[model samples]
Target: MKQDHRVVRRTAAALAAGALAAGALAGCSSKNQVPSIGYGVDAVIASYNGGSTLGANSGAAAVFSRVLTGFFYTGPDGQPVADTDSGTAKEVPGDAQTIQYRLSPEGVYSDGVQTSCDDLVLVWAAHSGRFTKAGPGGPVPLFDAASTDGYRDIERVDCQPGSKDATVVFRPGKHYSAWKTLFNAAELMPAHVIAAQVKIPNVVTPVQTGDQPTLERIADFWNNGWKLAPGKVDLTLLPSSGPYRIDSFGDKDGLVLVKNEKWWGDQPRTPRIVVWDGHSDLKSKVSDKSVGVLDVGAGSLGDVNLGGFRRQNLPGRGVEQLVLGTGGVFGSADARRAFALCVPRQALFDKFGHPDYNVKLGLGAGPLNSRTVQQDSVYYQAISGAGDKYKGGDATASQAAASSGMQNQTVRVGYLEPDEQHTAMVAAIGDACRAAGITVIDAGAPDFTASQLTDGKVDAILGGTAGMPGPSGSLNATDAIASLRTGAGLNFGRFGNGRYDAIADQLAAEDNSGTVLNLLTEQENLLWSEMPSIPLFAAPRTIGFGDGMENGVAGPTKEGAGWNMDRWVLKR
Candidate 1:
């Protein structure tokens, strides 16, 4: 939902006052003394390409937000803010479906190559799902893109040879409201470098010619070439267009980023940033002055004892839920509903949700009621009441419902290993489901990946769905379509519903807010009735800022504290 402008102004004023009191308002006058600050992240970075399927983790997103500049970024008020320094996007007159993008004249990669139309075309081709190769079974997508929601609607991208501008045209009758999110810098790899790697004259030739073989070769490199490891990094392929570039990387020492000398924008306020894993002894490191900022889970706030650190609770863009598979113990809708009835959603929230954190932030201190919208959003509708029969661990009703081929059935719950929050949630589910004669097995794995959802290794998954709101401040229906529609890329639960998909598509294309709210109500009702997933509390994130660390605020999006890292100021 659209945040009140008054709240945004108040928050800004308070932060500015705090910065002045801490002497952090001095605008880099002491340039000779470069300040190096440590930033602890919650996950390990696997790749620099956060837009790829293999690199869709928070660690990669945090780093890429600093190393790459784009046309727009999520602002402090949770709305898109245009970045004129990188580029500008404008809609063509009388053509709502066409957008023209022009890169800044001074835009150049760290390797001194001018940013051009090649970069734009590369991102479009990779995400459009236009290129494919024959697999053992059939044709498979050449590029392993994370999600091709808005990009797949593009009719074509028009660009002049060697020009720094491009025109994107969507297919007739297809209008994407979230067009601003397309072609983020993190998705724009250096096309010149990829062309050299594939021994091609340029990337535009194959894309323009539709040469399948050449396109396949380029796709193969894009899929596997940019992966990051602990100690191994290829500098030639990792050029930065933003303010920073990777200087060093290690599993133990963490990743280091230094200012990009070739950057054309204003210099970054912080010269060097050291990123550490939050799973390590971050509290001790903060006390010892080894770490200066922390992005941690709200559940761990109780253990933090940093006296001078400023802690802020940021509402996450996702909701933790229990997703059921289509086969095995949860095959039937009745069985899935029974399992949802037995789940201790309240218990799980009490254990890990940190209600006090939300209450202090002026939000409801209870389990989330809607899957599509956050609790505090103005458009949120409390549809969970329709499933009141499943509230507060309804063992009797669950037992009665589980008697039909569901009694004594065992279901494995999969989650990422070493996650205290998920582990505790799984244990609670087991304890509550016991009364219904259902067995909940903990299938935690160290190397668990999203592939498990399709492999059927686990009957259900304890995970979350990203909850990005639309421009109107309501949960974007297109985002819901990506996760719940039949055969959607992010539909890990193998859920399929033609009716739900139709309503979601209509909601995405409709600009009328009243009609959207009605559609959302219908969508939530279907989700609760079908039990594809059980909605839990809204996920909570906390940011801890050490002394002299200014402008390091937590964003509501997945980027978290690193959303504005380029503007962060450190006073020693």
Candidate 2:
């Protein structure tokens, strides 16, 4: 999971509040001392939904990615590994397109509900887009999934309750490259919860158009009702389907998780885990030895000492890009391209990039970085030339803006408000664009809310999308392009191009590594001309820890520092 500046600010605020609360607790009573149980990790506890910004950005995904067992878990080497501990998914004998899955007999939710096929049905409904469209000609999805990759290919799902057995039939000739990674590691939540809340007659069958009344009710709840907070948590509704259960929560006190007694696997090394949303000051926290681990991020206490604690840089799997909202001032490709020229990428880096990392365009290409993309590829070579022509503050952009009839355009630039990094970056962009006779208006929002993206108010935004890197160096190139398509979940900019969509679809269908890379680079070249987005610098993964913490692993991907929390230990 990756995010923009708003997420970073939200995390800081939450952690700061938690720290204040911890201080208050200490002053109030003798029993207020930190618990001597499981090793603690600093995190921002936000919304619980796996598909939303709060889940993806605030490190809350770990509750689902690590605590709840998925069908397969992504290993340390960036490859999907089968999670035989939870279940087995195999191809059906006579049906090459269908896959069958059977759960481990010991698999059970924290509430003692046996893991069943019904849960898989819910996941299928959410990801398959079956319950996303409400009526004829409706453009917006009722339930917006995070990634509609493999699930969109599922044609049918047949599940038997109590048996924990199910079959998923894919669309004819639809070969999903990420099939193994789809459901293996995410919590599908419990089917019975939705069934009871929405008044559904049966929980095992695929939800269809006829069930819109009940399905819409379920979608509404799934979208917002499941949010978690200190005193506002609905424990009965958000039961865990994995190894740990939420024990308590608070706005300032932070969230706490305990080992599930019904967990069938090896007991977690730590008995209880306390997650502080914010510690007032990292330096003080380390000085007092109050925090066990600190999950530092970009622009958060840059290059601060850990008071003898260890520091390790993790593999970051995302990039920061400028997404042009094609519906407003940037409706013209020339306009978008001219504006891209004024994005002072280097200046923004000068303001924010520090001791841990530096800012570079990740090779003047698409959102795919050099880690998974070949710098010498034809596509990279092509886009690099185009990118160099702009290079913020260059006179070429000034002439281009004038020639393109955008010299005096007032482009509203939205970003995360109250974010120091975004404030500085936007200021630099304003200065650069003003030099080109274009005005950059601040239409920034508080956070990465969906409403802010699609309101058709802002002309452009400084944000990013999470990338999927493969063990074979094949980037899920289509994911970034797909976000610019019509009816795409993350297409907040209202940008769409039929020709680009056709090429992206082809790229999505390709499986060969070399072929995928070729198509990816080609598609990036095409998008460069359209300029729906300008690839910026790659986000760095740097985290700080407290003394005596060991084996604290930041997963090979951008899932975040908490992904491998179960393996972290404290040496006394």
Candidate 3:
């Protein structure tokens, strides 16, 4: 069913000479003050202080995450670096799993330090694994375990030292496969730059008194390092294998992201990206100007009807999920199926600003919906014998639940209610469930904590998988599955079908499908069959930029380092 939603987001446009008029040209010689040329979309609201900042705000995290090395790099024309996601990019079987990587002989950070397998080892450890001050307990997962030479995960380190192809390998526990399926989007960091500092991609004030932890120390010498904070935007560019390098950045003024002059591969279509700081309004300036700065803003034009602009029709990357938990507080399969049928997907769409905001409330991330468990999944397909009775609310068929040994209980639902966005959606889904005869007992707040799960009030929870570059596995199908049955996971709903879990386990250990996807169509098919968590919608990435600011500023509806901010230009 197609729905036209009115666009409610405010918007504006920058009219400049036809795109062909602006091309790449270098200018130098900064006087006392840096003469600047700017663009239209640079105004992003700044709230919260650093690490404790809004965790739900991916808009900020996406930009902050880019301050250092991007997880994976695409080519000048948006192509993934050749073989970047090769064998080394396999899944692990256990949460204690780790994957090693070998750098290409040619890999180098912007600072000229050659990238290596060690960097991957230490960096991944820093983000989620142990090795830093924080031990590897909790939900933090690392890519490489003990990143010593000839390590478990790393195959080779490429040129400089540990650089080499097929040198790195993943060393996840037996269940590592399940974990890998859930967390493939995390970018590996370079530890060389972060060695002496207490943290990799160190945030917060550098330790002035205590001796900073060295690479060796982090590797073996007590793993003494600083705690990482998401608060600070360390513009300090160490280096990276990705296309663009960080030229310079200020505390709050924003970072100037220029193309890597030393970039070894084909030059990027939009070479330089100058990210502006903070969300501000310079309306008149944008309309009357032609300068060297490609703008970064969040405010729309005062005169332009933002309503029309939003309706202009665009794509997005907002991910939504329906999770089922073993809260045991909920009903059995029969009851769950009844609840699923009652979910008002249509109303949920209507409330979130359809077409514009709600866009396509289609379930899950994969083609069939939820990426982790798909329709064709061996697990799902095997479970398929359960039949359509699970999806549609046919009384006669539901009666079969009694005959088939499916339970009859109403599952309680816990959902994320961190802010306005979460509240509305949760309410809508609740209404849907209410119509279906299932009572959606409000656990209160959309930002549901893990403790909520153990409390067992949550039969189902609403959440989303981290956005993957493309439609692939369940963010980490095996891990997502493991999370359901064994290890703790974002899958607050402890949903596990025996057949599906087994297939996911096998698929995780071996990428027989020839893709890095966690949630493939098979998984989606599985979700459709199981309806553990009803698939809700595909998340959209909103990117908006000045129309004529740069020659090739072509990007998504919401502008940022993620898209065409690099090739943008200023009119003279």
Candidate 4:
């Protein structure tokens, strides 16, 4: 039942020296006169929310994170810092879960309307999923959000209209490790613009103004009205509070941003920034010295011929995953484990140019990156030893199959066809599993989305999860585990088990940081034991900055290559 596949290794040697240096380091600085910075983005941003900007693509995330200021900012090393420059948040006295926020009086949208508590309330509602059950669809969220961790626990919001102050109280006994990271600047979209377009009846009201019907109407416009296209670009409609605003969107799939005159913070170093899409030829871009900056995320270093360009190792915030569909060929734990045991995880990572790209073999010791978990932590030690169950390669896989009668079993695995590296990795997986009597069928698709696998279109999927770092510089397992829970929005594998859910619930209730880490390790152990999904490798963030681009840094900051973008300047 072994299927034929080609396993080719890209030149991973290009990133060996650069990855060793580690940490966030700036590229070569310059004082040359350059008109603007032309950087490469990962996605063609069309919508301002929902399935567009906040989705899996990091390009839209980069733009939103920079232009919109949040209550908190994540440093290059993934630590959360309260952003007093734009706003201030303080815990209310006598209330363990209540916090008060005050915005800068100078903060205003591009249209001159002051950004106030109303905006924060709107963002909190959208991300909290509080109004989801109010709709007719029965527990369906009005607006799709990237993460709903801290917001979902919100009990009440007291906002002073026309003022910049608001108080938010969450339900008691709830624990959120990423409380500060939830409402970061990148997530605070323009509320006034959305309200105006939606045309809600009563304009000025308190934080809880929108009812079920009114909120649905507003959500409809908020999700679709902000979408931009060539010849359909409405410059006036896209009002923003960030340091920059959308100037123009070209028909050729290019986006341009210019300085925001209403910006409340310090002026950015570069006045203009342009982003292009689908430009995979980094070698040509570097050789021509045309592209000033490039986000080489999970790209092959062997193909990159760096001459004068600087390779900056971005933070490893992505994990390659192999998800098994319980309803399909991997209906039983034994079947799933047999195939996982045969997978050449190292080989698959090698093809992605691991080590060179600063890619780690797995989450290392826990659900988060190795850097976040202490070496002596119980969770770290558990994950370190958890790999023993399936470490024998072909022999281990063959034995697992023999025990479960899964030998020569056929399993269909799907991945995005456009992702050359993923395709190569899938091929490597197929080659490795063949000797164990498992056949991995290639089910490639164009631009694979979460809906595809979740809807049962594919039996198994080659997927990934982005790292969400906490205040202590470690990765939080809450969002990752929450998303994969049965019926969760991002749960594409349809993995459901009461035992797993109970463990996850227990993990969520633990208040102490140490307890959370131990629980995270337990969750990971349960996941590995069940074999619903196997962690492949952490995708390394890599970017090549051309000459004249000063203050360009690459690290494992959750913000991607744009972490220090405000300070980035094209030497003029």
Candidate 5:
């Protein structure tokens, strides 16, 4: 679940203009005269390849969930379910480390090409962390993959030239518990399209032969090829394998999806779906019958008129936290602790975590204590009350600690601009830290990117720790390991502790439930003491369905409201 830190922000006026342009196109069609369903999104889609580092976001995940078909998809319960319509995955008998995948005979891409083993091999190669280039310090991955958790354990993939069947073998004693999640539709791209882009005769041969020059070329294209803009997208490079295909896209207008003519599975009930930017004027759009469904942040729920709509609040898969940098004014453990002590977690929670919202959402109303376990889970244990000291806004003890060597020190706090919750959170931090003789500066920007942390542009970032959902509706331990382990890909805070990393590793690998719970407790205690990041609250999302729609429930996973868009029916 590792993703880039850039949050998409577009003004309402800009987005409305873009939506009007897309609306004009939808009005041109009369045969399928049903009105297009308008779905709202929060971010701009820069890349459609969710497996690549650049495309790993909620915006891309929601759009691609309908445009791509694979062996498995995240179900309503937040677990991976086998998609028999696309393919079949089963473990080989007598060998727990081997799994075989066979694509459906009728599965084909939008361009009339059959979905085959070549696509699987290309996805595996890009995500396996196998292709690397020599750096001055060490080897660096050529392809910027979002996460290599399960893929790195793969030994080899066996497939013929153009077969639809592929066999995957894992390394000896390397049994990944989340093996069912590998090569999902969100991660699979068209390999033939990529091969043609790089002028390679075929994708299977280069991966099988370990052709360095050819692999490097493929990696270069994989990393930077699929990036999109409002009017600059090349449709040929973005073919669809699922029931829907991207008819048009805009940064502010969002994505317009139409039924794929080549799709062989169940046809989509709605002929067209327009994913509009949720930042626009949703109230008016819904009233004018232009927008039929709204998926927005819970904080913005007040802005929308809920009349004639069925509204439900969903507990988001991401956790909001203040990510502290490891190499700045607050680099030392003591300084980080002092800052945490001054944060008013309870007050912040009381303001944002209204009991009414929690009651409707079926969520616990409090700040989350553990980064690994959600508050509503049976395995949740409040191991550390260390954060209890920060309930009040008083910072007398924090001030005493800062007086020694860090008095009057200026700390810059960064966040994604145009965000109401994050902006208020940053302001609250400034107010609380002011009494501690610490000057907190607001450094939020509209174009803030993840590189700011590593490049020292900001000392801390108030962002969400978006993790992949596990089988039990909790955050996956593999994602926790990826975010905290030493030199791990998702370790944005650069917090490293050998003991904590070991506990996370055991938690991810352990099959026994009791052992995993104990390991999670150990990990929580360490995070509380280390103060690498302060867990604020589990972010909440709200979805509203107009009277004209049916089966528009929100998903608990990262795909948000459109996880099951193909099943939605629009009433005439």
Candidate 6:
């Protein structure tokens, strides 16, 4: 695979991104001399679902297209400027019931509006009757807004007393840190520019918290508020704070973005261009000679071979355990344990997964075969320490104690969804389980929502998970326990224990991963002893790219061109 930082992987599915480098060596092409002749994709970007953050998970959406820029920037070491650790919403836990955040003095909007505490209020207050008349999306029990926040913890946004001070706070919602989780989806928006002519006062913050907003009226008000003003917005634009911005643009599908001269940390290459042509078929449009340079993007990985292009293979995050339905079908913890023990993870890893993906993992973590998700998460460690649980059904381990101390009459295996790679591994698991005297039926694929497991018919299915990725990238035990919070997506296995929960909560709310390791190690053993979901071979992230594409790296690898859009230039 053409692994390189230029194609850094992103959240959602696959991110489409990048500007073409100028070059005309053997394979990878060079950029166009005429600005009018810049290159871009045609069909790869059929929709605009990703937005600037590339927050959504489509492999094809994120690309070199510049996200609107902010005036100031957050460097690698830039301070987060937290108000306090205590309170309902802070990253750090404290005695207070709320935590607030202020924009850095360095913050600036592309339109040049000073980013202040009010802007923070504008973005975080969507749930506090600020965004719309609809609702806040997080901390369901506390504010009836948690569920609406689209899986994040967010309570309110507020402007502080001055230009230098902006604050975002998590409310004392029923759920612990639930408000903070909701804000995970938030990005800094141009507050002054967006607010200048806002037609609706509610829009100072968003009303609907769903990834898909419900208030069309408010959306229109925000997007076209300037039409009411009938003038161009003088908002400053820059690439300094953001990864990319519009320097110039092609009439139809091409754009030129310049690295922010005011960037605080990294010095990105200058004048990145993105162009698209809908004139031909999807494949033809991307490979057309008229396109000039070949830009690296998520969508570009499907068919090309990076090895053939002499590009390096970037590393991806490790895979997580594929848990099956807990309450729905894989009812007994022992039954789950038995199934896991029967999985041939080692075999799969040697053959298809990471050659040596034997990394620590936990309840909320996935396999640590790659760098895709944070391998150092507490969740991953818990799963890893529990590795022994898979010894079930095997002669070496004692028979798993049935939740009811009886062998499961019917064991139905489930899958997370369409990762496909997981399905193949599950088949391997089923084969091993069958040998252990367990009857496992392939339940086909799962819906992304995981609702399929709730239906009585599905006993178990293939599954995948994610965890926080701090630098070390190993799973932390406390993270595993905290991950069991009601409706926490990755804990579909429904793992539990009073001590584990306490550990999980403390670890999740705090930055102490080291202290939780031993606890997680024991937790791993207990879970493995019981076998909830067999830890299969960690999923391997693979990449490929076609010829004629150069100066760009592939996704599924470190240092890929996917995120480093500015690094891309033509090779002539």
Q: Please, what is the TM-score per model?
A: 0.88, 0.80, 0.53, 0.82, 0.86, 0.55
Candidate 2 structure quality by residue, lDDT tens digits, 1-572: 32221233234334533321112222334332233323233233556666543444334444455566767654433445566667888866454477888888888877777888887777777767656554676645667665466677888777765568888888887766556766755446577777767776555643734476677777777767767767898777766765567777864445667777877765655656666543234444545565566544355443355655555543234445667777667778998888877777655544543334432433222323222233434445443444555456777788889988889889876754433455666777888899889998776654434345467767766654422111011133323544666566656666777776665556556767677656666666667778777656544334544444444544424344455554445544
- State the lDDT of candidate 6 residue by residue for 1-572, as single tens digits: 21212222121112222322223354433343232233433212221211111111111222322343322111111111111111112344544344445445655544454445544443343323333334376522212121123223445444433355434444454234323333221133444544444443433434324323434443443323312011222223222234454454333334445555544334444355554422223234434544443333222224532332323222233234554556744566655655565666556555444422333342112333211224444355344544533433465322532333324445655542333444565566666666555656666542232334545556653432222110001121212232343433234444455654454444444445566565556555655554444444332333322333334433332112233344444443
Off by over 4 Å in 4: 1-31, 43-46, 50-59, 133-138, 201-210, 228-232, 251-253, 278-288, 313-315, 349-353, 357-378, 399-418, 442-446, 466-474, 477-479, 497-514
* Residue 492's lDDT in candidate 5: 62
| Candidate topping TM-score | 1
lDDT of each: 0.69, 0.57, 0.36, 0.59, 0.68, 0.37
TM-score of 2: 0.80
Model 4 lowest lDDT segment of ten: 2-11
Write candidate 5's Cα lDDT for 83-102 as tens digits. Answer: 77788888875454899999
Worst 10 residues of 5 by lDDT: 3-12
Superposed on all Cα atoms, the candidates' RMSDs to the truth, in angstroms, are 4.3, 8.0, 11.1, 8.2, 7.4, 10.3
TM-score of 1: 0.88
lDDT of 5 at 511: 87
lDDT of candidate 3 over 1-572, digit per residue (tens): 21110010001112222322233233312212222334334323231111111221212323322223332322211222223311234322434444444445565766776655555444333323222344457433222221111122332222232444322234434433332221112234455555545354321111111223443344341221211222343444235444566555543344445566655544444544444433323333334442133322111222332321111222222234456654353335544555555565434434342334422222221223344444333444333332333333334433443443333345555543322344555666555444344445566442344336555756655544321111112222322343344322234454657666555545545655543343344554565555566644443222333322333332321123243233333333
Report the lDDT tens digits of candidate 4 across residue range 1-572. 21100000011122333442211234434244466777663443555552222332323455555666777655444446566656787766554477888888888888898888887777777666666655465677777665565677777667765578988788876655456765665667677776777665322352376576777776676556777565578877777777788788774535777788888777777888776543334445456665677664555323566555566643354455676777667778888788878887655554553544342333332223222233334566554456545442557788888787678787777764445566677778778888888887778664454455556777677644521111012255333565556555545676787777666666655667677666666666677777777766555555666655556655343355555565566663
Ordering by TM-score? 1, 5, 4, 2, 6, 3
Error of 1 at 325 (Å): 3.1
Model 4: per-residue Cα lDDT at residue 31: 43
Candidate 1 C-alpha lDDT tens digits along 227-309: 98778998888889888998888867778889999988778888988887644555566667777777655554345576666
Ten-residue segment with the worst summed lDDT in candidate 2?
466-475
